[model samples]
Target: MLAAATALFALVASASAQALPSSAASPEQLALVDAQYNASGFPDSGAILTVSYASFVVQNGNAYTAEQVATAPTIYVTPSTTTRDEFNSSSVYTVMLADASSLGDPDTEGNYRRVLQRSTHYLVNGQTGTSTGSNYTFEPSGGT
Candidate 1:
């Protein structure tokens, strides 16, 4: 039992060190997501945008998997974004994502009902990228 616990701990630690990115939503993408959030008055701001993960292509310098990427609640902060129309309409932008049981319980308690939120940092028109800090927050569904 003790050995199993140790192994589990090691696995989690390693995963954190290897957090991954699903997709790169350039600055252009973020602008769209932001517009949608602002227009919606931040109404479940996340739902207005779409988020997903595929095999990590390459960013600064790292390889990642979908499961590893899903551990984080802040998908947008990592490098994801929304469409052009969505960015133009939203005032505040955030990325919506599905959380897995291993990471933690979702706030909705429903598997698909869960989501991750991220706010915008800076923006530029005609540019296809945005810079994001490591700022993010996760809201779980239940106390369990």
Candidate 2:
């Protein structure tokens, strides 16, 4: 009975190991992903952006799968027009997943979600005037 139990344990271990993904991204692949992300121009603002999280997904193709999370910087802008006091505010956070080639360029199959908020304030002659209310949009790619 002990021998049989040992054999069963070994079988379970082997099966578990086999069930894991063999094509997981390596450190080099992750570096490539970072480079691609930096060059993608997703953050076109002056605010500093940084990656908060990253991971890999296993798929049935030659492409490498990666997911990244990033944050946008708070922006404040004032218009020059003296007739009205105008200020703009905006912020965004994003999550993206992509299937990339060996060179780290995103392929056709990818998805991204961005949580964006923006507002414009206007004061005519320093008095309370018509102001654009804050707007929020949760944009996401159309895919499962």
Candidate 3:
């Protein structure tokens, strides 16, 4: 029950940070994330520019529930290179967040199909990069 918006805050927090140029995502990165989108009942936008993950940590609560995230929670943004040699630590990046209601349901014929509504939570531009490295902690307050 992970909150989809958690990634939005993480991007908002990471907008000022730098691109973490890790060993480019594996060859299966795009497929993996694409499959995720399909499974989540959302259409693929084909904009998997880079690899990113937002870790939301809430004290004494679960992210899946509304009561647990009454307010913004702590977010950690980690972005890495998507390809082998196309990432520039100084270039700008964009982040988008969308909400998916369910993991898809079966169709009338008993075949699984995506059948959930998708609403965009946020789309951020002017996302700059920070230092270059594999490990960098970016928080809304600032770098740590």
- lDDT values, one for every candidate: 0.27, 0.21, 0.37
Question: Which pairs of residues clash in candidate 2, taking residues 3 or more apart in a chain or in different chains?
Answer: none
Per-residue lDDT for 43-65 in model 2, tens only?
21221111111242222232321
lDDT tens per residue, model 1, 12-125: 111111343334434554455455334322322222122223532222123334454543222222323432233221233322222222333233655323322321121222
Across 41-130, the per-residue lDDT of candidate 3 in tens digits comes to: 454322223223343332211135444444433333443333323233455555544442334544553332221234454455555554
lDDT of 2 at 49: 15
Model 3 TM-score (2 dp)? 0.38
Give Cα distance to truth, residue 67, candidate 2, Å: 16
lDDT, residue 103, model 1: 31
Worst 10 residues of 3 by lDDT: 8-17
TM-score of 1: 0.20
User: What's the C-alpha lDDT at position 52 in model 2?
Assistant: 17
Best by TM-score: 3
| Candidate 1 vs 2: which has more TM-score | 1
Give TM per candidate. 0.20, 0.17, 0.38
In model 3, the runs with Cα more than 4 Å from the true position are: 1-23, 37-63, 66-84, 100-120, 131-144
Which prediction has the highest lDDT against the true structure?
A: 3
